[model samples]
Target: MSEVAMKPEIRVLETADADTFWKLRLRGLKEDPEAFGASLADSVDATHEEICKRLACTDDSFALGAFNPEPCGMLGFYRRQGERVRHKGSIWGVYVAPEARGTGLARRLMVEAIERAKKMPGLEEVLLTVSTTQGPAMKLYESLGFKEYGHEVKALKQGDLYIDEKAMMLRLHD
Candidate 1:
């Protein structure tokens, strides 16, 4: 079967995947700047070591990657560390290449992240911010039990263009 017709492998990325991850991330930033809080200029200078460090997954922080033999989608998750806020975690940098879209890859990645979050001790909720322009993403988060708790106007600015964002939370425990 064609690779695209087969199920892509999805797993927590490791340091070895840094090169592919970085490339895909740069593609995402360049293709859709407003969809992310990060800018190509901000990430263009990132060194290999820095990218490797980011992929060093711990129990509380990690990135997931989808690969049909090459990186096609990515997501990052990190739990807060302060004693007063350790029960919360945040999801960031979600992106799927255009070729990987409409394959249910985004939802699959989110479900994997949520499942991992549920396993972390003391984690009561998972938080994520989606630009208002990302209607499909907002709907996907809502479908996965996330509720909008707040909205931030001008949450992100890309070249004088303001991007509003909605903060959503998924309660995992009482």
Candidate 2:
């Protein structure tokens, strides 16, 4: 039998969503170690207060959540702080619940994040890094207009295994 897919409604996560978001964030880090720059062991003990502070958004940075009535995915955007670097932003901590894969939820999350980045003052581009082995994820980013700009060897290591990543960027301005 074929599976039915449900669409996710995307929104900017709020302070009230800290616990839910944090739980999912930890799951992503633990379940998919190579896909992230941060490690589960490093952040597993993070407090709810810390997560709440992160859910708090400013004019330049925030996390977007995908809701199918529940928080199922998240993507974060952050603008560079210095005056000279404010024109650029980065997409981070992108994760979708395993059961929600193939439902176009991730593409929606990226689109939402990129659209929001485009509206940020002085921001002209958004950047991300994806592990070379994550072909499906790389394909999604490429399909969304993120181009590979460079590569780093052994960028992330879990024990003796090293994972490489390609630096990618999507231009928002001409």
Candidate 3:
């Protein structure tokens, strides 16, 4: 049997990584406009404070970065609060640089995010939404054990076009 190539190192983002994280995030948004709700054009005029606020949220949230001597991708998970919703967490803002796309960085990021979700205090499952056009992303998530639990019709409107989103979930057993 052939051997699988090992992936580059991945680690949780620390306070010092805020700028690097933001740069990679904006790059992802710019390159894949249809994959996310946020646009680089909109974020271009955003202040450093706005970007800091986003990168600084780590209380019940996790932001991971994959590196090959430099940051190449990022993925984040935010645990739901409120007594009723605390059992769930949402995976959001997943992205990999174009140069890193075919190297399995996305899968590595998802693996780290899922492991983090499984360790959350009361989390029963993790949820994420993907645009219907992102078949590759859908396949990656599904391969990692996420099920297509539901879909939101015309959930996003982009310049006269309506896009549907598929809601996916991965359950962690008690």
C-alpha lDDT of all candidate models, in order: 0.92, 0.89, 0.83
- Rank by TM-score (best first): 1, 2, 3
Off by over 4 Å in 3: 1-6, 57-59
Worst 10 residues of 3 by lDDT: 1-10
Worst 10 residues of 2 by lDDT: 1-10
TM-scores vs. true structure, each candidate: 0.95, 0.94, 0.89
Could you list the CA RMSD of all candidates, in the order they appear? 1.6, 2.6, 2.9
Candidate 3 global CA lDDT score: 0.83
Per-residue CA lDDT of model 3 for 65-141, tens digit only, reads: 88876789888888888999999999888888877788788998998888877777778999899999888899999
Give the winner by lDDT: 1 or 2.
Answer: 1
Candidate with maximal lDDT: 1
Q: Candidate 3, residue 124: CA error in Å?
A: 0.7
TM-score of 3: 0.89
